[model samples]
Target: MARMATHMITGAGSGIGAAVARRLHERGDELVLLARDAGRAKELAGAFPGARTLVGDLANPDRLSWAFSHQPLPDRIDSLVHSAGVVDLGPVGELTTRAWRGQLEVNLIAPAELTRLFLPQLRTARGHVVFVNSGAGLNAHAEWSAYAASKHGLKALADSLRAEEHGNGVRVTSVYPGRTASPMQAKVHSQEGKEYDASRWIDPESVATAILASIDLPRDAEVNDLTVRPGH
Candidate 1:
């Protein structure tokens, strides 16, 4: 019998991450969720019984190596899904350095660090790496400089990793979803002073399906990038 696949996921608390975790859990795959602290790790553990949780704050990417060193990591990781992110919208002149740093650390640097730490397992398992990036990663709009810049960096990271890991039998994919109807969307709406409407955007489950498709593909082929936009 084939061994069960193990996936290490970030942002499993809500949104697309939650949807992805739910699907994987339901399908009997193993999950390792990344949490910012012990409390959050406990919460995720409760949410997904039988799933493991790792406490590593994405806000401080520099600390992840040390953090993981202190914790037990999975010996086999079939996939690493980076779905956690932070967004603070502001014009270039108005955005604070803290805001820029926060987004960059969470959306860009942390994923890179996490991937670096897990490359050995990934290469051994011939695993996949999925990056949940935003449409902003492809295009920057007004008042979205910092967030977009971070996402754009994420795109470059994914692209470069894909190139570098191909020889190792590891696959890299980036999913660029247009504004999804999630808490993040609500927050973005609030920041824009616009009334929130969840119905108009793509569903998190849809994005999850796309992500799973990439992960489940035959080893002979790989999905390099997937772009999902709202139907409406």
Candidate 2:
């Protein structure tokens, strides 16, 4: 089946990535879904029928490189969404070096490496790069120091890429969504010693819609950043 558009999404096994996959599939786009767990990625892909699934730990550069080397990239991708991330929460005083390094590797370094790998394809199509960030990227949240630091670093990555890639016709957009309802949020709530309340969080579907809006922009226009928060 020749599709009108093709998009690649990281973290497609669940949460926002899975939502984006379904939404893109609904829009008649072909997909290449990447997930850390092979079984989970395949199960998610099954829902979409034709979506290709690849399993690679984005935190490991060598492994990620090897995985991409084996799996064929689309000749021209319409969009690349970096939604895979790990969050480690602790006060700065109690944060261990190992914990900090782990978050940085998965949240910051890995995404950079993956983005670099896709540059050639993205440039070929003048495609869009979307980084799914958090409000933590915009400001510090108490006890979320390590996670905030990683997100801040991610925001920097997006800024630098946008300025550098713009000349190549590759548009970059960072989405800072506040308190989205997901298993991750449930974990955060546990750390905060608060009961998880799904109603207070923004739906992942809304963030996925925002990504599509950025991709839908005319060639002459680009959405540099999109920030969404629940009305709480």
Candidate 3:
């Protein structure tokens, strides 16, 4: 039997991250889940025996440092799936400094730091780095300036990593998923004062399945970017 590879996923407590965790677990992959909410993370771990859970808020610099430093490692981690993110909706004129800063910290800076921490292992394993970006990462939509800016930053970060790490055999993939049916989307819908329409959004499970397919690609092939949107 082939050795089961380990993957670390941030934001595994809910939404797309949670869905990916479940899918990986079902497929018998070793998992390390990092979620800010200790209680929720622990609860999720109960369903996946042998899976590891780390509690750290992605926005907290101290926690970010602690989470990476404290974790035990194998010679290499097969992949690091960056699924944690925050969404803020507003026109550029209405965007607050705090909101803008918070979004950038979690969406951009945290992932970069985590990637840096895992770079050596990733290089050793020739592993893949998957970023769960937003449709906003591709273009700015009305009333989503802050969120779009942060995701745009994330897209650039992924692009740069792919170029810089190509020689080391590391593959970087950015998944731009549009309006997935998730708690974050529900919150955005509430903010817009519109009826939450689950039917109009892509399901998190479907995105998780696609992510799995990306990872399963033959070593000779690389999927640099994947954009998933609602069919309707």
Worst 10 residues of 3 by lDDT: 66-75
Of candidates 2 and 1, the better by lDDT = 1
- Assess every candidate by TM-score: 0.99, 0.95, 0.95
Output the better candidate (1/2) by TM-score.
1
Pick by lDDT: which candidate is best?
A: 1
Q: Model 2, range 126-228, lDDT digits (tens) per residue?
A: 9999999999999997788888898999999999999999999999999999999888889888888899988889999998889888989899999888999
> Where is the poorest 10-residue window by lDDT in model 1?
86-95
lDDT of 3 by residue, 21-105 (tens): 8998988989988767768677868967889877668887446776756666556778899999988788788888999999999
Residue runs of model 2 more than 4 Å from their true location after superposition: 1-3
Stretches of model 1 off by over 4 angstroms after superposition? none
RMSD versus native structure for model 3: 1.5
Structure candidate 3, residue pairs in collision: none
lDDT of model 2 at position 170? 97
User: What lDDT does candidate 1 reach at residue 72?
Assistant: 91
As a whole number from 0 to 100, the lDDT of residue 165 in candidate 2 is: 92
Task: Give the Cα-based TM-score of candidate 2 against the true structure.
Answer: 0.95
lDDT (tens digit, per residue) of candidate 1 on 1-232: 9899999999999999999999999999999999999999999999999999999999999999999999999997999999999989988889999999999999999999999999999999999999999999999999999999999999999999999999999999999999998999999999999999999999999999999999999999999989999998
